[model samples]
Target: MKKLLLGSMLVLGATSFGAVVEDLQNNGAKPAVLNIRVKGTVVDPTKYSLIVKPLDATNTTDTMQFNFDGLTIGEEQIVEGGYSAGVYQNNILITDDYKIETSLKRNGQNATTSEYDQMAAAKLAYSLGEPQAVGREYRGKVNVKATGKAKGSFVDNGVNLEVLVKNI
Candidate 1:
């Protein structure tokens, strides 16, 4: 009787341990939510046009890119330096010489901007453009593009620009 009781206790303990391990594994599989803010100034509004769209628009089967699934862009807000009558419409910000900013949120928080360069470098990429086989629809990353009036026109990415506007 004593040996039988010991064996039962061991089985119960192992089952409890397995349950804890499973819980941890499931929790780790959950996705994270991320919020990305992009802000920049247009040095020459007349010379450049900006477009914002989903990252999947740039995807190709030939090239691997970051999985930007679950990203959505908010409205672009003109911070300063624009004409008094400037406006944003059709996912395009129409304004003259302005500082602009936009926000992108992902998954509830699955991806982040910091992970962009790393994932791109690692080649562990996926596209959220099409619906997944699992019947999940994801809102993916925002693609912000700036094009100049002339062909091959140059525009700065604004990684090192100073504070041009404030108070708004």
Candidate 2:
């Protein structure tokens, strides 16, 4: 069982820290930060499942996926896919930050968990880089509801999950 638990931790850890944010402080640009808060019901509160998609003004075909398959539910989750610097800087981030659509599932069947809040969500703190007048924008937004034609992607059996996005 130790191996199984260890493996789970490794996977979760990788999702939280994939690549370091780029350093653009010399260019007079400030690093961008995103604060994601989630609430409502889910399949397994103890399990974490998420997806991050980069957004750009003109381009809409870039996305990155991560698996946080251990953290519990109803808490604030902090995900830093990479880093950003300027707007239309040619090499700026695809989008200002990212949009997350989430759900819960298990054994290919819908599951349920107790209420989750912003405090329980994992925290993804943004590192400083450079300062800029404008940054990327939040694109492709999704709001999980109790009943309104479940939107976004689903996990093992997650069908009633909720999600919220914030740019800080």
Candidate 3:
């Protein structure tokens, strides 16, 4: 009975050590900061407004497959005009400023001016983390919703959209 107990202890110890080793070997390096960028356009700004949100947004059931780093991440499908949304992951880090910048252009002109108040309302609806080191790396998500209405006819590329993730 004593010999059996000792053998059991040795087997358990070996199994635990093996697991630790396997984890260490399989643990690839994660990015210290992930820069996510979403770029798309709204076809007819006058007829429809652009709505951008996370795939896992509350009460959100529509989702499209998005490929990120070879992994399939859920994407929120844009139901408006010819607008398609996607998330792009960048391993680079933004050290200077930490903020969401939105740019809208119609016919190669800035659409965020007071002349385009409705378009200027475009903003970051949800942001996960701040630009600060709280003793650990920051990991979260951001959602940008650019809403606007242009006074013009339907052009194939009526509005241009650009959303950049500086820090988090």
Which candidate wins on lDDT? 2
- The predicted structure with the larger lDDT, 1 or 3, is 3
For candidate 3, write residues 1-168 as lDDT tens digits: 999899767656654332212222356653344334566643543332223333342212232211111111222222221222322224223244344445555677655431222332221121122222322222223333333232221112244444454454
lDDT for each candidate structure: 0.29, 0.34, 0.33
Per-candidate TM vs. native? 0.17, 0.20, 0.21
Clashes of each: 7, 23, 0
- Please estimate how well model 3 matches the true structure, expressed as its whole-model Cα lDDT: 0.33
| Model 2 misplaced regions, further than 4 Å | 1-61, 83-168
Instruction: Point out the worst 10-residue segment of candidate 2 by lDDT.
Output: 141-150
> Residue by residue across 96-120, what tens digits does model 2's lDDT show?
4544333333344433332222232
Report per-prediction Cα RMSD to one decimal: 20.3, 20.0, 20.7
* True-structure lDDT of candidate 2: 0.34
lDDT sort, best first: 2, 3, 1
User: Which residue pairs of candidate 3 clash?
Assistant: none
> What does candidate 2 score in Cα RMSD to the true structure?
20.0
Candidate 3: clashing residue pairs, number: 0
Tell me the tens digit of each residue's lDDT in model 1 across 5-112: 997686566443322112225457854444344666445444433332223323332221222221223212111111111233443444434443332233444332
Higher-scoring candidate on TM-score, 1 or 2: 2
